[model samples]
Target chain A: MLDGFAGGFIEILQIATLMTMFVGVIAGIVASAIPGFTITMAIVLTLPLTFYMPPIQGIATMLGVYVGGLTGGMISAALLGIPGTPSAVATTFDAYPMARKGDPGRALGIGIFASFFGTLVSIIVLVLAAPPLAIVAIQLGPWEYFSLIVFAMTVIASLVGRSLVRGLIAGLIGIFLATIGPDPMMNSPRFTFDLAMLSSGLPFLAVLIGVYAVSQLLGEVEQMRSGSSKGEALIEERIVFRPLSYLMDTIRRPINLIRSSLVGVFIGAVPGAGGSIANLLAYDQARRASKDPDSFGTGVPEGVVASESGNSSTAGGGLIPMIALGIPGSAVDAVLMASLMVHGIAVGPRLMVDNPEIVYSIFVGLFIGALMMLLIALSSMRYFLMVTRIPKHIIVPIVLVFCAVGVFALNNRVTDIYLLFFVGALGYVMKKMDYPLAPLVLGVILGPIAETNLRRALSTSEDLTLFITRPVSAVLLGLAVISLVVFLRHRMRPRASADS
Target chain B: MSDPRSNNASGRPDRPEDDAAPQPEGISGDSGLLQFAFNLVMLAGFGYLFWEAMALPESRWEPLGAGTFPRVLLGALMLLNVIMLIQSAPQARAELGHGPRQLFGVAWRTMLEFRTVFTVLGAFGVFLILIRPLGFVIAAFLFAFGVQLLLGPRTWRNLVISAIIAAVATVGLQVFFAEALNVFLPRGPFS
Candidate 1:
């Protein structure tokens, strides 16, 4: 067993491992620092380039990008008051305020520390939860799996803002796109439009980039054009590391860590919802629990602590379902799932029995990754903070270029570039029209699973009512109906009130 | 970059939910035009998707035809557009009365306000194009330096420092991917 671990990853343990770590740490910092340039987007864009590399290194590089992107967001949120990604939004409520109050150093310090703690807790949860979850997954027939997808889609509870109709429309659009490519059952093509590339359907990464990155970029462009000062100053008077006392204080607020970590883990376990909502829920909980609730939006270090910890911890939480059920729980996890498949690493229960080394390596990597983040965050704090001084004008173009390169680098087909721009235009138009992008993304990710599984489940039963006959499927379908109704009700109430 | 730090942080109540909420304010000016343009585009996209779906070959499973999902999507979209049109019906008058003032107001405001944001996005796009052909190391290094420059960090010291940082970062990533994870870096023209 030791030999398996040793032999398979022999190339990694040498100097190359150190180099990869360095790259990951640096990439993490940069991607995190840049607003709207998410780790998932970065990894997706870079993955195609990795096609030329050996499997292990390619996976490691992407993994490095993942870790880097996750950790890097704390830098901007704490120092500059901007959350680089949705996950970091909670971090901004406290970190930015703390930075402004002249303790940017303290805010950043506590954030990194809390992040480490939350991550540690999550890793433990993953180790305990993965195998059991995998076992339970064995019971999931196509009917059960379809029901689970229905349950996942029900997460529209969180996404359904005042504009539920618009959100649903976007989601339906995503499902339609999922109907593209070939049918798994009858070897029939669904919506190929006679185009060969479309036969494979829309690349998940392209859709992801379009909805998440391009739409965001366009929105940013609009926001930038609205006249604002480009003034620069360091709100933080000092930046240093004094860890022990802070650790003790965090321990004192054990409930904060635990509550937020649990929120992260649960949300992570739920497919499609991802860390964005977890971080938000954690931030809300932190505020509700604070001795001074008003202090939250104004920049309490506790707010920063809860949020950074909550969101970062979801990395571990998200891996649970993917490893156990072969169902990706977030975009990054989805990419990781793809990587595992690329490396011929089977997911689900069989993987547990067959590949203990890979599993153990992952467990070890999670532990080591968290430690690396702490050390890297501390040493790189000053450098990351300096990013705030870089003007917006320069940053946007660079990001756009990276997106272009990243998109094209994947699959070396020039057609992907055309797809990127087409999707970009679609994204720009969508943003202009005020349609939410998240549902579209979640739908695209979850659609195929829902559709194919539903068809298969129905096929087996020869009964349309079979969905309700099975207890688990019936319950899941019930929940999905109830959630959709609830969301629609929420939407209707607002419009009725507004009109009245 | 409005230094979100300065936004009335005296433990003040949030700037009213309405400000943050998506409610349309005073049905005049750019908002109206934007609404119209977007409405038309969405209408067309949805229409095309629906049309294409309907044209697809039918299967034995009638309800679950290839075009079923797309048709359903377009139907929903068309309904949404109708609702949006109703909401925006009041703005029709503003369209007829308002001249260049309203349009320019939104344009000029965006231009002056988000200059930094524009530069950043633009430069990033350029960096991506240059990267594959130029090699990851050089492209990344140049990209970071370019961003710093566009952000107005003009001194040679700042430029050189950022360049070194970018170079180190690119090399570090390359080494990690190539040696440790076994990812091969694009040799580009350098090799």
Candidate 2:
């Protein structure tokens, strides 16, 4: 292990490790500082480029980006009312309020500080949890793998929010869309539109960029046209980072951090649940736990803490399933999985057995990356906050331009550019209406998995009752049904008098 | 157009009671217009999608055919659109007056100040085109400058900085992917 680190570090130094870290942090900050664009989109667009690089360097760059991106989202949320990423959505509710109250410094400080701490906790879990889980995963057969996918799919209802029916509809819609490409198992074409590229199915990255990034750009443009004023740009005050003191203080509220991190890890452990739901669930749990719940939506530090903690932890937890079971736990992790394959690194149980040295290297890399993220995030919180002071009109165009380039960079195809615009429009409308965008994104990411497996299962059994007859499938199906019922009942309930 | 049984969700109270009297403006500000516009656009987009899917080649299998997934998605999208339109019509009219009046008015001044989106896209387009001809460094420099122009920095200092950002991003990507990972980026004139 020591020798491996020594070799990896030597290679890392030769590859301009500091430069990679710097570039990653900058790109992450820019991506996270802008609304409509996300770490997932940034990572997705960049993944193609990794196909061109050496394995270790490419992997390290991605890891750096992941850490930086997670913390960067808080910049916009703290400075402006807008959240740079969905995970930061909870952050904005309080951070923006606190900023408005003229404590932008403290708000930004607390968030960055909390994010650094939370990420550290998650990294520890990743280091410990992954190896054992990989061992357990080795015992699984095709039936178990199929059941695991079903279990992940059943979690969709929990993410659906006020409308499980709508969420299911969205999920089904996503599954249907996933069928556009050739079948994974039989190599038979499914829904190719006679166009050659369609045979490969819809490019998940293109869809992600289109649905999330482009949609956001269009929405901002529309909103900009309406002449909204964001008030005076927030002025920053001095914020001291007392890490020891901060740690002690946060440890006193260990439940909040532990609870949020666990929720994040769990959500992240499930393929497709991703960061958005993790942060949302964390925020919800935090609010529920707060003695003065009313203060949550106001300028409370706990909201910032919970969101940053939750979202950052997801980065660590997301890699667990991917490394252990060869299943991507989130979109970014999906990129990681793809990158590994491109580099001829076989994932799953065999990866650990064959490349224990590399596995240990990755663990070390991730741990160091987490610490670096915390250090960089803490020191630079003030700078990120300053980014929010830029005018919305200015920020929007810059972000949009980046989005276009990023999208085009993926496949260098004009079709993807158009896709970006189309998805941008869809996102704009969805935002304008109050429909949640996370589930749709989640649906797109998870759709193919569900469809491929469902078809594979059916083809193997050729029996309609196979889903119910299998014990694991039956359990997952039951969970989905019960979740649907619970979600509907919750939505149907009369509005709470106080909130109304 | 004004069917009495429409049960318009946009219906404002007609009562003249001074306190509870509906505002003179109709209910649901201009959301009705917005919603209608949104629905029309979605319809057009999804309609094309459905048509395209229908045009695809079919397989011998019933559900596993080439057009199976797109057709299913198209149908679901159309259904969802219908429900959304139906749901929005009433709510749009009801909330018409409550919508962002100023957002649409002259206050939308900032959008005109800097045409960042177009310039950035144009610059990026040029970058891709010139990558083979200009080499990574040259193309990257132009891309940076173009993005800076789009950003509309008030001073040359900021413009220079923005340009540097573009250059760095380009160079970094080139170095990592091409030099390190050995992935091919276009090596035009300057390469």
Candidate 3:
């Protein structure tokens, strides 16, 4: 391992690989800073460019993009009060408030340092626990997978606005939408409704861009029309990035940082729970632990620290299962896996034995990528902060245009463009109706996996007891039940108080 | 992008009962009633989809047929809708307050309030329709330029900036995808 680690460092130290990694990281930051352009989307676009590079080099460069994109999301979330990526959703809760309150720099500073430390912690965990975790991950049956999704779905109750029923409705609608194409277990066309477009199911990218990005831009316009001052813009403070101070503060509150990072890593290791859930769950944990819990959503630095660290760490956490068990934890990880497969590098339990140098190099590359992201984000942050200075009207139209371009670029299908508008309209109505979009998006992403596993489990044995009989599956289901109960009880307490 | 922080805070919204419960939450009046009606329509749609799922061909080999999962989902969806219907029944009652004759008028007023949303959606719809025939670049430029021109006070300055941004953005994305990434974007008749 030591020899491979040394050799991998030598391998990555090559100038060409380093330069590409730098460029890829920069591009990721730029793309993810744009609202509606997700880290997954940026990685998808970057995949083709890496087709020509050698295996390790290509993977390293993409890794740069992945880590950079994760951090880049905080830029927009803090500055413009808009989450650049779904993972940064919680960052907006505090970062936006801080920025609007005239300290965008501090928000970004806290987020950046937190992201850096989070990545480091996840890397340490990844290096130490990946082999054993993969062994355990590979042991998960279809029952466990389904139960895992069930647990993940309970997070929707916390996320959905004031109404758990409305959230469930949104999530159910998402699951139904995902079921539109051929059945997962059987190739029989189930709900295509005889339309050619429905044959392949709705593209995930289009739905994400439509639901999150398009609806957001619309909200921006609505705000413009409602607010009296278009002149106020986003923020006007002379930005001051105090990285050392934020780092010190974060280190002082080691529990929040460690707990949030652990939440991210553990969630990331779980297939289907990626950064989206990680950030929120981490924030919720932080809120629950804080002495000043009420101060969270109102510009608390702890909230930003919890969210950014939680999300950034997921990159390494996601790689753990992928490198060890050959299962992808998220769509971006699936793409990363695909990139490796294209190079004929088989990923599984034997990956380390077969390519120790590659594994070691990837580990080293992660640290390098994280360090590079920190440097680039700090230097260019002033420039990124300048985006807030642009007037809303100008930003609005240009962003919408970018949305159109991005939608069309995915799948090269004009049908996707139509779907973007359709989903966008649905998102708008849902927004107006006080329904949460996150539940819907999560349901869409994880529904198929849940369905496939459920069917597989049922087919394997008609006995549904397999879910409960299995220790891990039972634990997960128990956890899901506990989560639902806690959420319900928590919600009822406030209502009962109001009623009395 | 969706600023869901306020929504996700999970604040306790007031719930209206069928009887003499004082107005509950942001959704107490006519809008709440409209939501109940919307749920009813959704219930009907889900019911229809459930019925349709019954007709899908089930493979003889698999123990669980393909339709089973969807049927399960539809059942859950239908149940959820019923709960929503129960919760918002008061709103539906309020809708009948001004007589059933004025329902259309109330809905029209609500729709009119979202004029900006509709107008923006209209421009997006036009862009979708135009993209295939006019190609991505032209459709994008037109949409950006048009939306920018209409959004706030339509200064010529806004027009110029929008125009430049639209053109530059459209061309840059097109060139980048085609030349650098080898992903060719569609070109219209002019190109």
Candidate 4:
């Protein structure tokens, strides 16, 4: 391992490799900072570009984009109250409010530091525990996956703001929305309503951009009309950059940072779940564990730290399965595996034995890439913050156009853009009614996964009791019940006290 | 075990002063009527979907079949919407106590209050419709320029700036995606 690391370090340190990695990181950051652009999209775009490079250099460059994209997502999430990627949704819960409260610099600074540390932690875990972790993850069956999703669904408890019923309704609506295109198990249509657009179903990206971005922009318009700042920028406060202090602020909550990163790593190691689930799960756990949980969504450093760290750690965690077992953890990992395959390098259990240099190069490259991302983010943060200075009237329309273009670019489908408009309107109405949107988005993401697993598990056996009999599934279900109970008890306590 | 955060969960003592305003009952006043109406529409929608799902072919191979999951979700949604309707019924009744003209007046005032949002949303809708016919650049430019003019100060300088921004964003984005990213946007006649 040491020899491999030494060899990898030398390869990555080559000026050509280092320069490409730097550019890849910048491209990743810029792509993910656009609301409709995703990390997967950025990596997919980078794939063909990397085909000409050496295997190690190509993988290293993609790794740069992976790490950079994770942190870049929080930039727009904090600045605009619109998550740049689905993974950054939890970041907006607090970071946007922090920015709105005149501390955009602090929010960005803390997020960058948290993301840096999170990558480091996940990399350490990946290096030390990859093989064993991949084996354990692969052992999980359909039952375990379904139960895990049920446990994830319990996070709606934390997101339900004032009313639990409304939150559940929103979440259920999202699940139903996911069921629109076609039934997961059988390709038979369930709710197409005979419309061509509905025939393909609502794209998750469109739902995300519409529910969050478009609704958010419309809300900004309403605020402009009502507030005194008719022609003013998003933030009028004088911005300050205090990177060192925010670093201390993030590190001071060492427990939250570590816990969130670990959550991210575990979720990323799971085959299907990725940073989108990790960010929310980490934020929920942080809130549940905090001394003052009520401050979670109110622009606290803890929320930003939890979310950014959680998502960033997934970059390292996602590489684990690909490196150890040749099983791609997510779409980005699949693209990386494809890049390696293009170089005639087989990626599987024998990968370390066959190409220890490549494995070690990846390890070292991640560390260097993370460091590069930190330097790039810190120095360029001031320019990104200039976004806050763009007047709302100008930024709103431009971003809306960007949103449309991004959605259109997703599949080059004009129908998807049309779906964005209607979804945006529904999201606006839902927002106006005080319904929490997070659970809805979460439901949409998890819905298909949950249904497919449930059906798969049942098809394997007619006995539903196997779900409880299986040790892992039982534990997961137990955890879900406990989570629901704790949330209920927490919610009821206030009303109980007021009555008393 | 008693959670430390529970004591302040509802009161949220740590919330910033600006956010400390009393939380509105989501089912009250004009908003209550809106919620009530929204729930009614949703209930009908869920009901219709549930019926549609019931007709989905049940696979003999798999026990659960295609429609089972959606049926389960739609059932839950219907139940939740019903619960929301019941909860909001009292406030909605009070709002309806006012005559039709009064209700109409309140609705008009609410619409006027959100006139800007409605206008922008309408313009966005038109932009989406025009994308295929007029192409991305032309449609996006028109939408951006028009919305900016409508929203921003409508002075001559602002109009020129809006026009410049609209042109740059639409054209620059098209070129960047096409040349750099290789994802071609719709060109319509420009194609």
Candidate 5:
């Protein structure tokens, strides 16, 4: 393992790998700093480019983008008070306020330091958590795997935003969509309805582009028509980055930094919960834990530290589940998994045994990427700040066209583009009506695994009751039921009374 | 879909100051009746799919046939849809008093409100239909220009610039994909 890791580090230091990583970092920073452009989109678009490269370079470059994008979000959050990404929503509560306080440099600087700390902490935790989890996952049977998916699905219902029913429905829709392809066991087509497109199943990349990018572009158009178009550039003044001064300021609030990062890591490790939840919850916890809770949203350094650290750390935390169990921690992790799979690397319990070199490279790559992000961000802070100058008119249509390019690029199939448009329409309607898209994607990914396991277990064993008789499976099922109950209780409560 | 941050889940700001009026689990506004109508349509679709699954021939080798898994899923979905209809009934009932004209106005207003979304979707539809016949370059150029024009800033300069941009970007991407990346993009006779 040590020898492999050492070799992995050597490979990561190669010129091609380093150059791609640098380019990825630049792209990630720029892409994510633009509001409506997500890390998932950045990673998805990056996939086609990475196909020809060696696995390590491709994965490492994406990782660089992952880390860079997490911090990149803070730029818009601070400068324009519009979070560049949903994860940066909490950052805006304080970072924007701080920037508005006439020290935009301090705002971004503090955020950068906090993000660095968060990533560092998360990497440590991921390294600690993944191996043990992987070991346990390796021991699980088909029944246990099916049960675990159920538990994950149930937990999704509770935390997946405003509507519990909508969340569940979204998940069910995903599972249904997954059922459209050939049956895992028999390879018999199930839901294709005799269409050529259905025979291959819905491509994840097209759905992702349709759901996120297309809908977001449409949303920008909607925002424009609403006459509240963010037409003018908010920052024209010279922007600066004072790393030394901000580093000192951030270090003074060690408790906030540590707590928020821990929060981020925990949330990131969960299946459905992600950076958006992490940032907000970390900020909330920081406020509650503080003596000066009253000062949370009003330009406080503590607030900025908490939110930025919380959001950034999730990158590492998200890697934990993906590396350990072959279950993607988030949509971004799903894309990362797809990238590795493109290289024909089997990702699962035996990933470590099969490919220690790749695993170790990822670990080392995380650290190196962090160092690069810090250096690149601190140096090019002003240049990135200028990216905000690009107008919405240019951005919206261009991005939509780019999304079409990405869709066509994926399979070179025009049918996929049609599917992209169809899914985009669904996404736009769902967004307008407040439906969650995550559960659908999750459902799509996990549906086949769940079904294949269930069928396998049933066929292998005589009794269907074995699922309940088995200890691990029973326990997992119990947890799933408990999650459902909790979701119900939360939904049923008269929060209206509490609000008053 | 858009945010992928916290907003991905709810399609709204995660930390809205007004905690009292929590966003509805279903579609917002005086649209419970509309939602219910949509649900009925879905229910009918699910029912048809369920019936089709029932007809799927089962093999003797596997204990659970291929249709079994999907049947289970469809059953669960059918149940959920029924439950949702029941839950939405009260709200839908309350909106029944709204006159047809009032409801029509609301629906029409919604369509107008979401004109950009529809227009963009239309552009994509046109792009998809044209891409094979006209090829990616021409289709993309037309789609890009139409989308921008509909979205506006439609001054003569913007239109000319949009046209030039549409042409350059399309050809540049095609060349990069074909030459640099060694991937084939659809080429029309003009290209």
Candidate 6:
């Protein structure tokens, strides 16, 4: 383990690797600080660019983006009172008020520090948890694996979107889309329809760029049409830098910081849940725990701490499932897994064994990324604030062009760009219809594994009853059932009360 | 625990219910009729795919055929589409009661409201088509410049700025990819 850590440090500390990571950090901050651009979009566009770099360096660069993006969101939330990303919604509750109170620098400084500590705590938990979890995960048979996927799909469907049925349908659509080209086992083409584009199957990267970047940009255009564009700065107050004082203030509420971070980690480990939920949940928890809970949204330091820490910690917590199991906890983690898979690196229980150096690099890279995020955010926040002012009209067209270029560069195939357009249109329709896109992306990633395991388990045993008779597999399936029932009840409760 | 933040110091109502309540499902008003129609289209597509899957060859070595998994998924999709169709029928009926002329007006207004989105989407389609013939640089340049002007204020200063941005993005991207990444983009006439 020590040697692995040392090797990882060596690989990541290279001048070229650090340079790209620095650039990635800047790109992430700039992208997320723009109101319409998401961290997922930033990472998705960054994917093709990383294809040219060595594996460790590429992954390291993305980690920088992930960490920087998490903190970058606080910039717009505090300065403009509009969340740059969904995860920063809670930050606006307090940080915006703080900025309004003529303490904009304090709000940003506390958030940056809280983010730094939160990442550190989550990384410690990740280091402690993932390896042992992988060891146990490696022992699971095909029955258990398939059952686990079933549970994951149900949980994801239940957690996301308003209607459980709609979420499930989106997931099913994704799995069906994955089934378009070839059958995993038989090498037989399933739904190619003799078209060359569908012959090799839809590229996952193209689907990602299309469903997220293009659709999201179109949504921004709609917002522009709706006349929500704030051409002038909302707050013109000068920011005062008092980083040391704010750092002390954030650290003074250690319990709140730690507890909120734990909430983030737990929520992030859950399939389909990510920073958006974590921030809110953590802030709620912090408010509940406070003796003077009434002060929560009134520029309280604890509020900023809890919200920023909560969202930032999810970066580490999200990595836990991706490292320990092959299953990604969220869409961002799915993209990370895709990046690794692009390098022909199989990401699963054996990942630590096959590429211990990569695992170690990840562990080290996250810590360094967090440190770098703190440094960059504290020093260059004014510039990030400037990014929030970029007009949606200009941003929309420019990003769309980037999406096209990135998708086309993925395989140097023009067909993929066409696929991106169709998928983007489909995604836009789904988004407008209120269907959540996360489960669909997860389903695409997990569909092949689910099918292969189901077949492999059945082939290994003629008795279909063994699936239920086996303890672990049965437990997983039982959990899936329970998850569905819980979601159904949760959805119906409010309507039932209203009827009464 | 009861959320104390619900009634915070900030006079702003911290209604957690806003996040908890699902946004009004699109299955209401005119959109409901559209949803019903969309569900019908999905049902047909899934049904056809299920039929196609039935013909997939089975392997003697494995109990599950190549088609089995996809068939199961398609079946679920068809079933869900049917459920959606059934759920939206009442709303669709209500929408239809508004009469064809009213419905036509609503649909026309919606198209007009989304005209910008549709226009940009159309430009994107054209760009994709042009990529093969005009090459990536020229196609991207035209698309970016055109869309920027269309979306932004139509002024001379904005036009010059948009043109410069379009050129930098296309040419700079082309050069970066070619020189640094060694990934040569399609050159077309330039090649």
Best by TM-score: 4
Per-residue lDDT of candidate 5, residues A1-500 (tens digit): 57866887898999999999998888788777755557887788788888999999999999999989998988867875556666886677677657656667888889998999999999888787876643454566888878866765663553245555656677787788888877888888887889887788887656655765666566666667765553433343456667799999999998889899988887787665578667866876676567765466668899899989999999888888788878887889998899999999988777878988888888888888888999999998776566445555665666666667666766777787788888888877666655666566567656877888888888788587877888988998997787677556644564656767
TM-score of each: 0.66, 0.65, 0.89, 0.96, 0.71, 0.71
Q: Which ten residues in a row have the lowest lDDT in candidate 1 chain A?
A: A229-238
Candidate 4 to truth, TM: 0.96
Q: What is the Cα-based TM-score of model 3?
A: 0.89
- Give me the candidate number with maximum lDDT: 4
lDDT of 3 at A377: 88
| Model 3 Cα shift for residue A131 (angstroms) | 1.4
The TM-score of predicted model 1 comes to 0.66
Q: Would you give me the overall lDDT of model 3?
A: 0.79
Clash pairs detected, candidate 6: none
Off by over 4 Å in 3: A1-4, A34-56, A76-86, A89-103, A226-241, A270-273, A280-303, A325-351, A496-500, B1-14, B17-30, B99-109
Task: Give the best candidate by DockQ.
Answer: 3
Sorted by lDDT (best first), the order is 4, 3, 6, 5, 1, 2
Q: On residues B50-166, what C-alpha lDDT tens digit does candidate 3 reach at each position? A: 998998778666677889888999999999989988887766676567565576665666566567767888888898888778987888788877877777456777678778977
Off by over 4 Å in 5: A1-133, A226-365, A377-389, A462-475, A478-482, A485-500, B1-29, B57-59, B90-96
State how far residue A268 of model 5 sits from its true place (Å).
Answer: 11
Q: Candidate 3 residues A1-500, lDDT tens each?
A: 67877998998888989999999899889888876668887898889888999988998999999999999988877876657787887888788888878888888988998999999999999999997876676678899999988877776665565466777888888888888888887778877788876787887767766876677767777666653645345566666767688778678778899999988988888777789878977887787577765576778889899999999989888989998888888889999889989999998778888988888888999989999998998888878777777777667767777676666766777777788888988887777666777678777877888898888888888798999999999999998888878767766886799899
- Rate residue A289 of model 3 by lDDT: 70
- Tell me the tens digit of each residue's lDDT in model 1 across B54-163: 87665575335455555676788788876666655555435535666765675576565556555655555565566558866677667666765555345787667666
| Fnat for each model | 0.13, 0.04, 0.42, 0.47, 0.37, 0.36
Off by over 4 Å in 2: A1-132, A135-253, A263-311, A314-365, A464-475, A496-500, B1-30, B33-76, B85-191
What lDDT tens digits, residue by residue, belong to model 1 across residues A264-314? 776676665556667766775675456665455566667777887788788
Tell me the docking grade of candidate 3: acceptable
RMSD of each: 7.8, 8.5, 3.6, 3.8, 7.3, 8.2
Q: Give the range of the ten consecutive residues with the poorest summed lDDT in model 5 chain A.
A: A229-238
| Candidate 4 deviant stretches above 4 angstroms | B1-30
* Interface RMSD for candidates 1 onward, in order: 7.7, 10.2, 3.5, 6.3, 5.3, 8.3
